[model samples]
Target chain A: MLVIEGLTKRYATGDLALDDVSLTVPKGQVMALIGPSGAGKSTLIRCVNRLVEPTAGTIRLGETVLTALGDRALRRARRRMGMIFQEYALVERLSVMENVLSGRLGYVGFWRSWFRRFPLADIEEAFRLLARVGLDHMVDKRADALSGGQRQRVGIVRALMQDPELLLVDEPTASLDPKTSRQIMRLIIELAKERGLAAIINIHDVALAQQFAERIVGLHAGRIVFDGPASDLTPEVLTTIYGEEDWSATIRKAEDDDEDEPPAVEAARIAAAD
Target chain B: MDAAAAARAWRPPPLIEAAWLRWAVYGGALLYAVLALGTLEVNWTRAAEGLERGGRFLGAFFPPDFVTHWLEIEEGLLESLTMTVTSTVFGVILSVPVALGASRNLAPMPIYLFCRGLIAVSRTFQEIIIAILFVAMFGFGPLAGMLTLAFSTIGFMGKLLAEDIEDIEKSQAEAVRATGASWFQLLAWGIQPQVLPRFIGLSAYRFDINFRESAVLGLVGAGGIGDTLNSSLDRYEFGTSAAILLIIIAIVMVCEYTSGFIRRAVQ
Candidate 1:
């Protein structure tokens, strides 16, 4: 479980990126935070992980007051949360096995890790995760040689290898095709279900969120504009969150049909441009 | 259109019309010339005397004699080579930690600063000066030359290796950090893979440089062929000196070729 209170973030230029906001993610639930670009989605997620420090806030991950704790305590608490990145973030030159082995780094001592002296159980778990992701053959292969989808799969396996209580995925499928995106989402869903772990996903795709997420939260201008079950996130809610009804309403209506397959790549490009 | 085109066309009209900045620059240049002329002496007689002396010195270094004193030549050459190879081995070994510590992207600011400062101090003086210091401290041996080469190699290779680490993909480092790896583990997993090849290449290049430096280090009473070279010069045995020069040229050429091959292979 994670609890955040009165989270505030301001840039050096004196712009409030995240204003007085609070969020709670209950254990073993997939809560998707849906928002347009620059809606402080990434900043919020980074703050939760303490990758970006909040200007003012209190974050409690289980019993640990993450904001109040010192660096060492924060790092210890951080081990319970595994972060997945859009770019996969796999060390290109390291082998798949090594990347997965990296997940146990929090538990390993510095010199022991440098010499690859991870515990036998951790190494076995890494191999088992590779097998779980259907990448057992890629154990010795450098991460750079893998395809985007494969790399993201490796990313999932690496995250899962941590045996984390909570998984944080940021734009998990942003770099992949629509089909691969769905597959990644399915994989995340299946793994979360099988492991009974909590997951908070930041996604740009509304249709994907509808397909996978049980609950959806929308943010706009550093505020949560909508919070409801997936079925309740209608065109009106999206229009409200995005601050423009016209285009999104039409697009939402279009996607409402069973035959509609949204152009994930083109939409991603347009979103990037905006 | 013709009037507009003519108006757009520009040219330098006259020297007098040159901008004040240009006149100021020319005036500064004239002032420099006057100052230089006042301070410097046109000593053609002394210059000619120096050139004549240089030519006489060169005239003595004719017909290199490799056959005579072949035993001494062999001994000096072996000592020079042993010193060079040992320095190369020791220098590369020492540079690893320094490289890791100096990399800004990988190390803490204090550690990075300390490593960089160490390298800076190492390189502050020429290798000969370091050799002289070592010789005075350790008392006239090949150990002094080796230490000098090792210290300089650490400075050169460590600096280049840190730069190479800085050039690595930041995303990979983030991935390691996200994994909650400690500082050393992060460097081992993320930074080492990216910098390994370049670091090896840099070490090879540093070895080549150290090889040349080691030969000259013996001139300061640290042990190598340079001791023989210094004695040859002292005795005015220019033919033997020429022979030593030939051997040194051959050694330099061999190192250059080996380093080139290594760089290409690694790259």
Candidate 2:
């Protein structure tokens, strides 16, 4: 379980990224966060891990207060939370097995880990996870040699190797194709379900989030505008979250949208429709 | 809109407007070149008179006298090799910490400034000038040459190594941090893997440079092939001097090939 209270993050430039936001996730529940660009989605997730220090907040993971901890205690608390990145941030030159083994860095001693002398049990677990993701054949290959889908699979397995209590997934499907995105999403959900793990997935695709998550939380301009089941997310709620666009027309346009148009042209088309 | 009103509204765009500045720089460079050319004096008659002596010297250089000065050349070549190996090893080892300290992304502001200042001081003087100072202090031996080369290597390797560290993918390091890795462990996992191959290649290149410098270090009585060549020239033994020069060329070519092979293998 995770609990957050009165989270506020004001950057040094006086820009309020997150203002008085608060949320919670019961154990084994999958929550999807959906929002427009610069809607404070990333700031919220990073604040949970204290990667982005909140100006005023209290984050309690189970019994531990992460925001109140010191440097050494914060490091210890971080080991319980696993983070997946949009870019699949594996050390490029390291082999797939080494990258996986690095997930256990917090548990192992510095000298042992520095020399890459991971314990036999950790090594075995890494191999088993790699085999589960069908990457056993390429265990010796460098991270840069894998395809995008394969790399995401590796990222999932590495996060799982941490044996984390909470998974913080940031845009896991942003750079992936539709089919690959679905597969990655399915893999993460199934793994989390199997382990009875709690997860907060930051996603851009509303339909995919509705398809996968049991609970949906919509954010707008640094505030939570909607929080309910997928069935409760209506066109009116979507308009309130995304602004005054016609939801039905935009959904139809998205289905037939060509991929060749630049982002500026797309913005102009949206404005014209509005 | 009326045509006259549209024409009145139109305004020409602003230009860079620095053409005069550019022309002034060009003119200054041309004047400096002309003045530099005027400073060097040449005497054609004296040059002609020296041509006959040069021809005789060239004639004496043939067959190289390698068989006669073989012992002296062997000693000088060996000394240069020792100096190159020793200086490169010490220099690369010392450069690692300095490079890490100089990386703005890694070290605090004070440490970064201190490391950068040290690098700048080492790079301010040429290797020959540094060698001259060291020879004065250490008294004209191979110690002076090795020290000079090592100091220069710290400058070259530290500057490049800092750049390589700064250019690494930041997300990789952030991922490591998210895994609860300590700072040292983060460096071992995130930074070392990215920079190791470049570090090895640079060390090899520095070795080759130091070897070449060693051959000329003896010119200032710092002990190497340069000293042997200097003595031979002083005794008017053109044949021995030519033999030493050929040997130096051969060794340098061999080092180049070796360094290239190493860089390729590591990559």
| Winning candidate number (TM-score) | 2
> Candidate 1 regions off by >4 Å?
A11-15, A70-72, A110-112, A115-124, A231-246, A249-274, B1-60, B106-110
Task: State the lDDT of candidate 2 residue by residue for A1-274, as single tens digits.
Answer: 7998899999899889888888999999999999898888988999998888999978899999988998888888888888888989889999999889888988888999988898899999998888777788899999999988888888888788889999999999998987667668877898889899999999988877877889989989889999999777778988888887667754444334344446776564334222
Interface RMSD of each: 1.3, 0.7
- lDDT score for residue B164 of model 1: 85
Chain B TM-score of every predicted model: 0.86, 0.86
The 0-to-1 C-alpha lDDT of every candidate, in the order given, reads: 0.82, 0.87
Candidate 1 residue lDDT tens string, B97-194: 89888988668999999999999998798999989999999998788998898888888888888788888888777767776666677778878888
Poorest lDDT segment (10 consecutive residues) of candidate 2 chain A: A250-259
lDDT of 1: 0.82
Docking class of 1: medium
Off by over 4 Å in 2: A11-15, A244-246, A249-274, B1-63
